[model samples]
Target: MRTIAKLENVSKTYKLADDQQLEVLSQINLDVQEGEFIALLGQSGCGKSTILRIMSGLIKPTSGTAYQYDEKLQGINETISIVFQSFALYPWLTVYENVRIGLIKRQLSSSQEEQEITEAIRLIGLGGHENAYPKELSGGMRQRVGFARALVAKPEILAMDEPFSALDVLTAQNLRAEVIDLWKNKEGTFKSAFMVTHNISEAVSMASKIMILSSHPGRIVHVIENKMPYPRNEKSPAFLALVDEIHGLITTLNLPDTPKEHPISKAIFENAESKAFENIPYVQISRILGFLEVLKDDNGRTKIFELAAKMKEEFGSVISIAKAVEILNFIETPGQDVVLTELGRKFIEAESTNQKLIFRKQLVLMKLFRLIIDKLTTLKTLAEDDLKVEINNRFPYENADKMVDTIVDWGRYGEIFEFNADLKVFTQFEDSV
Candidate 1:
């Protein structure tokens, strides 16, 4: 099989203020073959999009190499085009114009350009909406425009960044079906496609191969091939087994900073003051509490999507909340079904005062939370700027901001510390209970 694109030991790092560095992509490698559709799967912030960007030549890797057609890819390779997750279409442009944008620089005549644009729109099922502007179109229609634009370029490869993530379920499904049909039929210049997504079922449904990535400083842990035939039965035993296999890969994936999982690392885990730079997630405590209550009432088990529907929340948002809750050990998930833990159930069943106690205990157990308490205890009080400076030494600037917020918000809930907003200082809370 001919290789269409390749990344050889690629790595990426972002330099933060004061000479600190945040490594996003490690010595990872990937390839897009002549006719294979690959799905790069991992948690958010795992550098999935960074890999896509490197393949598309939108950004250069800090080390190693990204190549297309055996040539080094520097900035914007001509053989690849991207379909963004946000449906990035120009508001000032009509459907015709939006689809026509990619083909504008081609050497084709005006008539040829118009013909190609019209046919591209028709192929993506956006026929007769040529004159419609993006603002006038539905979400599905807008994304069709995005697909149309990428197709009109007549590129050999399409790089999609969670293209269907922002759409409704039916719409995403419909669009995925349409694209698969095109790939199956060899309808366009699209010889291959690769995309980044967090959804396992979507990966199994779409790609011929799936690359699983490890968290924080992304590295490819395994590449599983989907050998099942196209139009494969999602309900088939084989398909279910594949899903379960990949799901296991994720659930048991080791986090880089989780030193407690190893015997020799026990010393590090015991020293609360040593782990001062725990990577804190951006989830709100309220969502964690809310999900716990819902799970408890629902017999402590429910499908992820079912929970989302019951709570009238978006699927992706609920997943983020679930991840946060999972990290704190309040929930255990065998697959997509989240089961509340014994602690989770206790939190829900306890009286108001007892609930506070439970919440506080859980917060203190968190490495990030405990770190903040440790700092405040030692310093008596520290201004937010000083705390942020302390954080900047460990994390990238943007992530440092989030870690700061997580400590402040969760710390306040635990009453582990008191914050004076005007002074921007955090002080230890008075003893109680």
Candidate 2:
């Protein structure tokens, strides 16, 4: 890999009021290849965006160094552009002028800069609308202008801090596809893209490499390779499997001390403070997924306290046991010994046999919805055997039956993702069918 950027044992510390140095990032090291789409993923305050700033030379590491433009550590280079979460476009300037500003500052000819600005506007699908000011455009359109302005600079690498975080899902998905297309078409000249994102699926689907940073003192914990090809089939077994694997890796890192009342990690088994699934931080998600992993055995049945001891042994905390029970809905009474209930057994079996498959299938279904379709069809004729085969083909599991049961339940809960099931298996709305 051609080293486009690198952070060498980097550390950043800040002096507080009492002159106490607080470390934000420690022993951080990451190297990105030329034209590699890399995502830095972690919880808030994990220094994900900080690393981007460091790489962009917006901030200096207190210790160690970063290298860009193929040399020793240096200050920020001119060949970089950043698109902030907030579209940092100029309020006074029209979209054209806003984009033309960078070229003008570079001392390009008036005609040349205007031509470049025109090209950029067209590329971002905002051609004639260049006369519109920021305030005149909708949020999505304003973002499009920002993207055009960034591209007009013609930098080697682009740094985006949650660029689409504010957009609605439909618009964000379209913009994401457009950005990916932009990168692909301009690969060598553009070099690569580096970004910070809270969305795991966005990271997984887009980046060639995803680096996960740990919290407290932020630092790189794991780096994942997205081996699946571009225009990735999010619904395919391969893509989902990779997503689950990454989820597992993240879960292991944030698995906390075991609980006193339960057999699961507090991070995994949530009562009220669990952040309502989607709002759950990445750190918490990782631990929750890991705890779920321990609830199952080779067969899809619950393993009682055997898995409990194994989990505790690995995590070195009693909270693991408590969380395990909570997640399994396994009751632990003072008079009752540790045993798996019917619900607990089913949960374990479902998790053990079907969690990854379900996750992958759902993601794929989402992808299918994004692609244009002519006619919708119904899956009512998908017999039990056909459903079984579809599950096996798209999301294989050790326990196909258990996986099916879970998938049906997910469908019932509106979590099964009805609108976009799979390109291979599309079903029309009930009335249309």
Candidate 3:
């Protein structure tokens, strides 16, 4: 029970071009103990991966320090290895060469390198594919090569940033089981592993400790230990209970109306007082409408967590979609549950043309869309560059393009206006108001 990696009062901030600091992680004080599997679970953009990079000495925190085995980490060293979501393999190299590369600068004898590579591949269940190129292997096999490459180094700690995320469900499940088995029996070279994942069941099943991170300037809000024994049965009441409990915990946790003091991110986005260009990411309009239909089929009321589980989507993705629904005033999210508003029900019941009409009304009501409409009326043809510049003036420079693009998509899709992509201009269509 020795402390291996520690983050003491770590706060990381990225300076943006707008002279604004994007706070990544704040006051993160945590540690990894010997023989512990720690899962950092949170929404995307929560800076979970940033924590991994900081611990691995891949990046330095703006404030606080990262320690490896009681020593302040100077830089990336051989003591730790990371398996990334992407295979991170040289496509031209064979599996043997890829695994062998990790031991390149170690000054090991040729015999030593061969032995380590062979054993690492074998342990990761990639025994016979050593000579095959990465292009010849399946995604799962390539990831096993990634595992083998990280393992051949004999690191004290293993860090993975959504390593299994890109694989199929069954494949990810099998890999998780294998890794958990290795940890259960102390087969792998590492004393502990840190995994950044959003999979609730995966975190509950594998991690001896789970850290729940909050979005918008991420922070570790809770750290819980798993008391259940190994070989956790997903069908069992205990496993289900843990899943439900965590889901409830997350959905109930203070998901503030205002995300981190930003009025623009608030559920009630700026009113007439301010016209801050909103940065809400656009999920496909079809997906948004379909999501509402699913909710409607569920009687127009379902908890966000329940909807996420049913849709097999991440909480963050669903929440962002719900935010869009909120922006259009199509759904009433009084709390964790969403209720389809009368406008939403009407839109669903309407015919195609009527639906487009409703969508047009909703789009025109948006602050950005209204501003665009105003510009089009004044200029006759609003250049996309001018629209982006207007957005940048109101919001962060980073989100300007995304914000403007989303606005343009809604404009064209809703039939509120026409967009000439080649000319990068917004023009009034025959149906435009």
Q: Considering every candidate listed, which one attains the maximal TM-score?
A: 1
What is the RMSD, in Å, between candidate 1 and the native fold over all Cα? 3.7
Model 1 bad stretches (over 4 Å): 254-279, 301-339, 365-371, 385-398, 420-423, 430-433
Tens digits of lDDT, candidate 3, 1-433 = 9988899999988875444556778889999889899999887778999999999999999999999888988887456789999999998899999999889767799898988889998899997898999999999999999999998888878899999899998999999999888777777878899999988888998888999997666889888888888888888898888888777666555333444445444444455435444455656687687788888888888888888877788887787778787778788776577889999999887888898899999887777788778777777888877776666555542355556677776777798778888987888876687
Error of 1 at 15 (Å): 2.4
RMSD values, in order shown: 3.7, 19.1, 3.7
Global Cα lDDT for candidate 2: 0.62
Could you give the candidate ranking by TM-score, starting with the highest?
1, 3, 2
For candidate 3, the 10 contiguous residues with the lowest summed lDDT are 254-263
Backbone-clash count (model 2): 25
Error of 2 at 311 (Å): 27
Error of 3 at 305 (Å): 3.8
lDDT by residue (1-433, candidate 2, tens digit) is: 5777788999987764223345678889887777789988875566788888888888999998888756866777556677888988899889888877657446777788877888888888887787888999878888888787778788888778989988888999899988888998893146789889866678888999898887546878788888678887778998877766765554455442332222222444456423222111212324534454554342333332334355643211223343333433433322112334454444445743464444434323332221211123332333334554533333221133444444343333323333334432434334321
Give the clashing residue pairs of candidate 3, or none: none
lDDT, candidates in the order shown: 0.80, 0.62, 0.82
What is the C-alpha local distance difference test score of candidate 3? 0.82
